[model samples]
Target: MTDFYDRAAAREAEILSDALAAQQRRARNGLGAVSALACEDCGASIPEARRQAIHGVQRCVGCQTVQERLAR
Candidate 1:
């Protein structure tokens, strides 16, 4: 009985952890119009599919990737 309760508690913790992570990701993604994709540096045309695939995207994939790399 005690083992079962411990397992349930662990599962609840896991679920809550996952929910918190998902919420954090959603918050980071932001909300914005799905307008034409543009480069952050030069206003270049970003592909339509790319814009559709990513949420709240502001920069081109190239620029975005570069920024990510630099961030790391």
Candidate 2:
């Protein structure tokens, strides 16, 4: 019983470790870890509504639209 419990705990720890690694490797919006005060591409002030709508938005609507177009 004790061995089974130990194995379960180990499995839980491994799952959490894998999740943390995946999150770290993820590329957050150009803002990095936190939301930016200004657009990363144009230096325009990021609006409160946009920031609230997209937790880590880094670009203003115009800049973001341009970037999306360029990507396409």
Candidate 3:
């Protein structure tokens, strides 16, 4: 007999993988306007370390998290 549970687990894994790939793409290409160490929204200090770490990050971590939450 076929195992329904196994099928469900496979589907869940596929969905999770796709979501992760999409997130990676966003992280790679989302913040294109962040050429300086300042928040485009609040003018808060965006550290040099952060910019280097996140490719093209603009807003600080707090602002970025809030925006991502709202997006979901």
Candidate 4:
């Protein structure tokens, strides 16, 4: 019973450690980065709200819709 508890604690610690590392990496990736001002496909300006909401958005809604359709 003690061994099982120990193993569970160890696993929990490892999972928490991995979660922290992933969060740190994601924060690093986002640091000093801004979303695109214009859509790559249509050369239209992206809205400020959308740009702030998305990390590295490169397309407007219309162009993204078209691209997604093409992808499918």
Candidate 5:
């Protein structure tokens, strides 16, 4: 009986963690989508292919790459 309860608790925690991670991802994507289609840092136009590939892409490839590198 104790083992079963522990397993159930572990499963519940796992589910909750997954749900929170997904919610965070959605929020980040939503914020990105709200940004202007043109690159925020540079005036370059965001390509259609990139917009289609990423649900909410705010920057052009070059700007995004630079930002990502700086972030690291």
Candidate 6:
């Protein structure tokens, strides 16, 4: 019984790890496809540094701040 429980725990851990890895990969791929031409909300030009720092960002810093505040 103890051995079976150990195996189950190991399997659960592996599944969790795989799911986390897959999520990370999807996030990276999604970010890579995002173009940093302009902010979707304000139409401001997104800075190169900002674009590089944030993956899949659609809004400029100012606009994003406002959006976060409003969400709360």
Top TM-score: which candidate number? 3
How much lDDT does each candidate structure score?
A: 0.79, 0.83, 0.81, 0.90, 0.83, 0.89
Give the best candidate by lDDT. 4
Runs of candidate 6 with Cα error greater than 4 angstroms are 1-30
Residue 37 lDDT (model 6): 73
Candidate 2 overall Cα lDDT vs. reference?
Answer: 0.83
Q: Write out the backbone clash pairs for model 4.
A: none
User: Candidate 3, residues 19-57: lDDT per residue as tens digits?
Assistant: 999998887685564555888778899988888777667
Error of 3 at 9 (Å): 1.1
Give me the runs in candidate 5 sitting further than 4 Å from their true place: 1-35
Kindly provide the TM-score of model 6 when superposed on the true structure, using C-alpha atoms: 0.55
lDDT of 2 by residue, 1-72 (tens): 579889999999999999988776664433345678999988999988888767778899999999999999
Give the root-mean-square deviation of each candidate in angstroms. Answer: 4.6, 7.7, 2.7, 5.0, 4.8, 4.3
**Residue 3 displacement (Å), model 4:** 32
What is the C-alpha lDDT profile of model 1 across 5-61, one tens digit per residue?
899999999999999999987866665545456776669988888777776677887
Error of 5 at 57 (Å): 0.6
Q: Please give me the total number of clashing residue pairs in predicted model 4.
A: 0
Counting clashing residue pairs in each candidate, in order, gives 0, 0, 0, 0, 0, 0
Model 2 ranges off by over 4 Å: 1-33
lDDT of model 6 at position 42: 85
